[model samples]
Structures are given as structure tokens and as C-alpha cells.
Target: MILALAIPAILIKEPWGPLVLALGMLLVASFLVWTLLRRQSRGFPQPYEASGLLEVVLATSREWLWTIGPDGRFTFSGPISRELIGYDPSELLGQHYSRVMECEDLAEAIRNRAKREKPDSSWSGLVTACRHRDGRRILVEVSGRPILDGQGQVRGFEGTTRALDVPSAHDVASEETRAGVEAMLISRTLLTAFQPIRALNNGNVIGAEALTRFLSADDRGISPEAWFVGAASVGLGVELEMLALEAALSAAASLPEDLYVAVNLSPKACLDDRVPALLQGSSIPLERIVLELTEHHEVTDYGPLGKALAQLRREGLRIAIDDAGAGFSSMRHIVELRPDLIKLDRKVITGINADAGLRALGAAMVAFAADIGASLVAEGIETEAELDAVRQLSMNAGQGYLLGRPTVAREEWKLWSVPVHLKRPASGPTTGQHKRP
Candidate 1:
């Protein structure tokens, strides 16, 4: 009525405003019709005006909005659920949130919920699998926060889930990789190869590094590193690493008791609670085990890792920083971790016999290791000249093609039970003749 009264007054003041007046009236009429339809559809009481608006917004959104009670049962599921997962909101109410989650994603969702239990805690962009009403799985990106009561305790959770449209090629490859890794884990088919780490001075085997090998027909052409990278891409990196660790530790049981078995592990895997349990349960004694930190991945924060390593060390297990001098991160790891051993990377050991800079770096590492009371091991000693160079530097131990190749044969492993003298090259120049760059 107010608009009706003001329209004539404006038209009388400006006679040429009929088109403007008609357009304003049409807009007002359309808005009234929309408001009326919304009110009738929602049937909300006038007192719930704001809630009515929220309902309209949620009904139109593509993302599914959800709320669950403290007990994890669905309290409310938006109308979008019907379009998103083929389940009507009414069908989802009172069901557990797990009802819509894929089996593999349930544990991850539970972990995220635990985080939300803390005050003001929220999580976003957690991509997980959701189950559809017809047994199909949908990939979704989820974001949520805990709902708090007046007393600041978590009352429930509210969240939004949007379906992800991954490119078909990438999605197919990821699914294949995930399935492959899962099969490998289930069948326990990973093979352990032991590469001897020898004493450079006496040419006697002191320890063997456990290397994981995938021997399944499907995995024949894929390198171990590629397999691990594929597993990581599909959110199964930790699972695969743990499986490899278990396999390596299990194989270590057959090796000589006097020899320490060095097992490679990523920092993230070390932080897993299962690691300590795995180590404790191993038949091999703690003192006979060495945990080598693979340098391919960077350690974001060393405090927790340091604490974890400290706990393991106190249990009599030694730690080695693998691939030291490969990069600045590796150097940082040595300074921060203060490992019992520092293994020189293949990059640093290759051609050290002739490169003055490489020799100087090797000499500096030898000095550094002695100063820190850590044993130095040269890796990838493929040629006799490389072996001569590392031996000349007085490296405590070395492992390479010249020493011994990684072998899965039990007979070859038994050969290390006795002292074996490794022949040194007679032609290489001695360390005394090498000039400092």
C-alpha cells in the first residue's frame, strides 16, 4: 500500500515516468509472489522468519548440509541429500553418519570428529568417500565444525559435503593404485631384500639394510619408490610403509644376531603409534635394530619426531640419518637429530675418487662424524675406486655394489655369518696424494 501511494505522487511530479513505474511494480509483484510461494512451501510460523530464510537458502544450495548429535546420529540432513546421495533427508534422519560414509573412510571421519571435540576446532577440505543409497561411492570434500552449547561443551556437529568431480583418467588411475596397494597389503606379498653394510676397515659385515621389493606380477615393472609414491597419492602411504616395515622387521629375525638391521622409515611413519608396538613385538632385539630415516621427505617439525626417536633410542635402538649431504634438509636432520650414524648419499659418494670438491666434502663429513661420535657409512660404492676413496676417508661402514648387492636369498645371508675379506683396488691413488680444493 505504501508503494502504491508513493507511485502516483512520483508519476504526477514526473509525467514521463510510466515505464519506470511499471518496471518497479513488476519487480515488487514478482518479489511478493516469490515470498508467498516460499512461505506456503515451508509452512513456517511468523516467529521462525529467519529459519524460513535459512531453509530456502539450504534447499537451493548444491552442497549437502548436515547436522549430527553428540552421539553421531544424524539430527538433520538437508533436502540436497536426495540429489547428492539418492537418499531423502527423511530417510537419513536418526541414522548414524557412517550410514552414508564408505567403509574405508569411516575411520578417517572418526579421527576428524575427535579433532572437532576440542573447543572451537574445525576441519576443511578433507576429501573422503561417501556411499550412495544404491551402493555406489561418491568422492566428496567435507568441511565442518563442532556446535557448542552455552557451557562451551560440544553439543553436536554441523557440516557441508560437496561431491568432487575428479577427471576420469586421473580418477581411474588413482582407483587402480588404491586397489593395488590394498591387495598387496591384504596378501602380505612384499619381499624383503637385505643389503650388507660392511665395516670399511675389516671388510666384515656389521649390518644389513632391509629394502622392500614388490614381486607381485602386477607390480613387476614398477619400482619400489614408484609404488610408494602411488600409495601416497591415494592416501595409503602410511599403510604401505607400515606393511614394508613389518616385512623388514620380520625378515630381520633370520639374519645374524650380531648384525644390526637398518630399516628405512619416513618421519610420518615413525610418529605412528604402531611403530613402537612393531619394534617391541619384533623377535629381533632392540639393540640389533637400527631405524634409518629416509631423506627423500622433509621433516616439517622435529620436536615430536625427536621425542619419538628419543623414546626409541632409550629402548636401545640406534638411529641413522640416511642420505646425509643429499640436500640442506639432510644436513639439518643430522644437526637436529644427532643420529648414531650418518649415511653419505650416493650423490656425494659417486666419483669422489677424482673430484677434489667431493673428496673435501667426504673428508669434512668424516671429521664431522668423528666430532659428533657418529659412524659414517658411504652408500653406492659401485666401483673399486669409490670403495678405495671411502675406505681412505676412514668411513666406519659402507654399502654398495662393490660391498654386496641386496639379496633375498637366505643362503647368501648365511655367508655373512663368517668374516669375508673384500678385495681393494691396488691402482687407486691414496688419500695422502689427493689435494684439497
Candidate 2:
């Protein structure tokens, strides 16, 4: 419209018409150029805003954005990965995802997501473990989405990693606890002590439960339970359990071949593929190693866990349910797992000799074990009466302070030829002590 009007004004040559036409033509041309530029600019990335928001995000964000091929090889690793894992960006390329992501539970979660996710879907909110380039382990929250090709095949994976935030008093406490546990693990400051599990019939030492004690920097001892809880909080439960198991196996190497060694593991740790790998490398015979499945946490899904345990059992490993009768759920655990041994909890065995109800409960456990073809091991037999009580109940095994405290001396274990207190009458004074040579 402006051009049609401008042409008439230019042709008439009216004084102001030429000037008006000139300005009109100029305005029309400028408008056309502006429109074309806008269309062209749409094909390119948007110009960065003056606020520099993208630059601010790239500079300040903590998440490590990453990409990996369908083959699980890293294709790109963000700067945060290099900073947190102590690896150069180039070092991560071509490395298998599992090389950096080693935790069993996290791997299982990833595998499950891959199996269940729809094409082009994303999974997130998973807190997982990743190995630092320095050989340390750190907990991170990971979120990932699958990248798909035109034909709908998964071509690659994209993800972000963020450091797990310690956001509450409980989390802060957990972080402190994890730091303490990590320090102990790094320093190898934990001491493995063996508490003898004796046959109640003759008090003959048939096996021993391996216990771990963290010797703090101040030379004070921290209980195994506390250390283990801390480890679980930090996603280091399996690793620390492996360490304790390794220590137990090392100590077992020097003991008499006839005496089996019982090592405790959480159900989750028991299912970890790393457990079997660790076992394979150890010289300890499968039959001589009893993996006592302690209720570190409740067993939620027993099918998969039972299958894993069954595999180990097929390899000649024995499974024992520790701390039975501490709660009713423990009995359910025994029934579901069908372990070879049921350890009566200290609470159940502590005063059974005096408390008739306790004695009856102990007897019931013995019968339950018998019905299931399992042996009952009574723990926390702290008195002669407790010993006599469990003996009457036909307990298959017993372990307690009264029998023997956790001993560290290898000579003492080697010289354990017979039951140290077996000769004493069950009615004898509780002081019938077993002296370690």
C-alpha cells in the first residue's frame, strides 16, 4: 500500500510528495528487511539475553550433565564430573558407565528402569553410588532420560548427577557418621574379633561369628552395629561388609579347617553381585563359610533375594538368620529365607533359665527350627543357668560373653582344642571361665 501511494507521489512531483514518497519507500524497505531478518534469525539459536542467564547456569550449576552411548560408554562428561570424580573430561570418554557407577543397588535400579521405561521416557530421583577417580566412593542423586533414534531404537542416554545434599539434622548426623566410617575404612583401623559359637551339648566350639570393631583415632572403640548403620546410610554398606568379610576370611585361613567361620551380611549386601565375586577370590572353602544374614534392614522383596541366596547355597554356602525371636517378623524371615540356622536373639536367650515364658519361647524356636530342618543357635548365654536352660531346650549351638568374648589372638584360636568350660557342671558357679592361651 505504501509503495502504490509513493509511486503516484513521485510521478506527480508535487513539492512535499517526492520527500514523503522517499521516506515512505525507505520505511517500507526497512520493514521488509526487519521481517526477513526475524524469519532468518528463527533458524539460528536465540541470541543470549543481556541477563546472561545461560552463562550463569553453566557457571553456577553443580549437576554434572553427561551422555553415554547405547553400549554404555561415556560419550560426554561435564566439567562437574571432572571436578567431583577427579577425572579429566577425556578420561571418561569411552569408559563404561559401570566403571564410574559401581554400587550394586544403584546398578540394579538403573537396570530395572531400563527394563520398565517406555521408549523415550525418563527416569529420575535415584540416589546412587559413583566411584571417584581417587578410588573413593561418593553418593549422588542421578536422573536420566533415554535418547532415541528416528526408528525408535535407544541411541544413547543423557543424565545429570548432583551431590547428595545433607539437608537436615538427621542428614548432617548421617554425613558425620559416614565420614567417620569412611575414615575407618580408608585407614583400615577396624579390628576383627571372633566370638566363639559353641555347641550347647558339650560346649565344643563349632564356629565363631566374626565381629568388627572400629578403633577410633582417639583409641576408643566403636561398636560394629553403629559403624554398619553409618555405612548403610552412606551407600557403603556392601563395601564395608565386603571389608569385614574379607577380614574374617583372612582370619579363618589360619584356623582349623573343621571349624566353620560365620560372617554376617545384610540381605541387600548378600544379594550384591560383588559378594559372590569377593567369595570367588577368597581361599575359604564354601562349605566352611556360613553367611549369617542379619536383619540390617527389612527384606522387602524375598523372591529375588531368595534366588540369590539359593545360588550361594548351591555353591555350598550356609545361610543363617541372626537375631531370631527379637521380633515376630524375624520368624517370618526364617520361614521365607529357609535358612540353615536360626540364631536366638540375646533378648530371647538372656534370662530364659529363670523366665518360664522365655524358656517356652526358646523351646518353641527349637521346635520351629526342627520342623524346618534348621539348627538353633542360642546367643547371649551369660550365665550357667542360661547355659543349662538352652541345653535343656536342645539348642544346637550357643554363643555368649559367658562362653568367650571376642578374641583377637591367633594363638588362642589355634589352641582351642576342646571346650574350655565344658568340664564344669552346668550348675557350677557362673565363673567357670574359659581362659585363652
List model 1 lDDT by residue over 1-437, tens digit each: 57764875588567667776777777778888999988876885665788888988897899999998875667899988998888899977765564565222433343444444543367666556665664444667688888999999988889998986633436786798789989998998878989999998779999999988766655423446556656776888889999999999998888988899999888888889999999989999899999998745457889999998787799899999987776667778899889999999765776677678889999999999999999999986766777888887788899876778788998889889799886764555733211101
Runs off by more than 4 Å, candidate 2:
1-172, 218-221, 419-437
Worst 10 residues of 2 by lDDT: 428-437
Winning model by lDDT: 1
For each candidate, the alpha-carbon lDDT, in order, equals: 0.77, 0.70
Q: After superposition, how far is residue 222 of candidate 1 from its true place, in Å?
A: 0.3
Which ranges of candidate 1 are over 4 A from the true structure? Answer: 1-170, 423-437
Residue 52 CA displacement from its true place in model 1, Å:
71
Summarize candidate 2's per-residue lDDT along 311-332 as a digit string, tens digits.
7789899989877865555677
Q: State TM-scores per candidate.
A: 0.59, 0.57
